[model samples]
Target: MSEFTSMAFGSAWGVKDWDESSIAPIIAREVQNSWRVRGMGDFAVGARECGSATGMLEKWKVLREDEIQKLEDVKWIGYVGVRDATTTSMAVGDTSQPTTRPWQQMIELRYGFHPEVWGKGFGTEAAKAIMGWCGKYIGAERFIAEIEIENLGSGRVLSKMGFEEIEKEKEVIWGMEGTKEWKIWVGR
Candidate 1:
């Protein structure tokens, strides 16, 4: 075996280190611009401060310390961008100003992609890669994912990955962004 790495594969995808070169911040802006995170959840969760580029910039500042701490704690898996890059869809017209947030709970599996890539199976592919990594290296017998009850796309992905609902409750999920009133899914 070539030296082992924490990153792995899912179906047709592979993981890439989401460091300085990552398009994460730009994609995050896309999500915000698309109103993907607006008015979500039945309960208020997070500070609701990530609805604008300005807000995201503030969040980017708050996440730096957490990112360092998470990696040090080994609770973080780091952001892994799927190895597919196409700049044709940047509605922002310029990606040079994109920002990568150090704020994702690295221990938790987080993902983001431009809306143009939605429904193309990339989300599922990357999620599976991260989930598989968690199972193999985390030394834990169980894993969980928080999905908004109305987030059918994510729910379907988790279900396809063999996760089942062990319980249902409204809760807060603190990620690079905040989501509230989420349905929890666990792997058996």
Candidate 2:
């Protein structure tokens, strides 16, 4: 994990690999709040059945944060990172699908930023840094992201980072109507 912690930085921000340090609780709270702010929706209903903040925090044990103390240009916005998809039941992708590559080679990317930084390019910047770090240190060859179809801002960020729409699925989101989920994929 120390290898993953040595994350690269962009001009405006950097990513610290998710860890159980004092920063973990902060990252957990932000990760929870950012989901709704980033357009995933409220978890008032079916929180556990659907992908609630509590559920996600437990599912995505591997996360990363862009600590403001580590940056000089912007306030602490949120997190952007990847996790081993083969090992975890991904929120979107069909984990049952088989891949010839090793489990470590395929990863799922997730990100969230404060509303203030929504229109800014920080998501792309932080995403690029994390992807670069994973590719170099984790030997990750494939990256994927599961986003709500309505989250065009995040789609734009993924597009900017060279991700392509690999698939889409319709599902019931907690406390919301059926929503379309877009699973984007890219190769390093």
Residues 12-117, model 1: lDDT tens digits:
2344556755777876665554333221111111122334556422332123324442333221212332111112111133545322312121123445443333
lDDT tens digits by residue: candidate 2, 117-182: 466566776677777776676666667665654566777887877776653343211112222323
Q: In TM-score terms, which candidate is top?
A: 2
Root-mean-square deviation of every model: 18.8, 16.0
- TM-score, cand. 2: 0.50
Error of 1 at 37 (Å): 29
The segments of candidate 2 whose C-alpha lies over 4 angstroms from its true place after superposition are: 1-74, 90-101, 168-188
Clashes (candidate 2) = 0
C-alpha lDDT (0 to 100) for residue 32 of candidate 2: 70
Q: Compute each candidate's TM-score over C-alphas.
A: 0.35, 0.50
Least well predicted 10-residue stretch by lDDT in candidate 1? 39-48
Alpha carbon lDDT of each predicted model: 0.36, 0.49
Off by over 4 Å in 1: 1-107, 169-188
